[model samples]
Target: MTTPEPDSQVGIVLVSHSDALARETATLAGQFAGPHARIAAAGGTDDGGCGTSPDKVAAAIEQVDQGIGVLIIPDLGGSVLTARLFERPSAVVVADVPFVEGAIAAAVLAATGAPLPAVLQAADDARTYRKL
Candidate 1:
């Protein structure tokens, strides 16, 4: 197998209060993104409790950094704060979209080689998605 172009596809980070939650979310989103998009997870505290950590967030961001950008999907306010605590000079967007839907949409767009702003928009647009 061959590798995708490093800068062509944007990356995604799933931040949650549970390590299992983050990994599961990333797995679900990865289905839509295929293997082209980089999807990482940053969840739980150092002791694996209900909390977020800046170090984990930074690691997730760094893991997905491919030169294009990284879109972060935080499960809650605390997760959002942790994700923002270690912001980078590079395009590290903290999207305000719903966790699951946002990750799916963002991953799909990013896999298509969408730019940071476009991927962000895709994630943001998921807010209106409904299952009626």
Candidate 2:
């Protein structure tokens, strides 16, 4: 099988119950990936609200899923649900990693032209160390 080429415009999106968490994660990921990486984020509102809509997540993924790659880090419940709703292309990866650090790291790796599998593996490594 031919391996897919690495994505150059790789981006990361965090879906969480708090907008701050999402934004913070995006910022942290930017630090790791540097100023040029493409990172985006969205969060669920409080007051017993549904987190960012699945469509919004899908849109974000679509926006970044160019030939490069796109990685999505979801908080919980809604975040995972939103990711699950999409039919991810080979160029896009949706990870259920709940921690910001791990997600950010994964995004950074993806942004640096790492393959999706490698980036996901890094995210999983981060997830293992995160204090859930």
Candidate 3:
């Protein structure tokens, strides 16, 4: 049996056009995400090309899902479309927020053991970030 905890666990899945960009962004977020942060990058085509693949996304979600829940962030329009195409488990949530910034916020909150809803809220809040 697992130990009972008060905080809700949530992981993040980043879907980007470029594999390197996705991994690099994940690394940047992981810096502040702490050890417990679960961030997965599902990018590029199945044949090692640039694009999002539903297969890759499903696999990424499976890898990151740690029994709590998952938040999906997509980089481009196609990436978002691909994320939407994949049939996810009930616990999956797709947040409409800036990909990089949202991932950073989500990673930080998730690292602190915040609940799934809280994490998604934080990511959604990232849309207000000042780009000026």
Which structure among the candidates has the greatest TM-score?
A: 1
lDDT of 3 at 7: 51
lDDT of 3 by residue, 9-114 (tens): 6889999999988888888888877655789998899898999888889998888777788999899889988887753655788878998999999998887777
Models, CA RMSD each = 2.3, 6.0, 4.0
Which stretch of 10 consecutive residues in model 3 shows the poorest summed lDDT?
1-10
Residue pairs that clash (backbone atoms under 3 angstroms), model 3: none
- State which candidate, 1 or 3, has the greater lDDT: 1
Q: What would the TM-scores of all predictions be?
A: 0.90, 0.77, 0.87
lDDT of 1: 0.87
In Å, residue 78's CA in model 2 sits off its true spot by 1.7
Candidate 3 off by > 4 Å? 1-8, 87-90
**Whole-model lDDT per candidate:** 0.87, 0.69, 0.84
Say which prediction, candidate 1 or candidate 2, comes out ahead on lDDT. Answer: 1
Task: Give the Cα RMSD of candidate 1.
Answer: 2.3
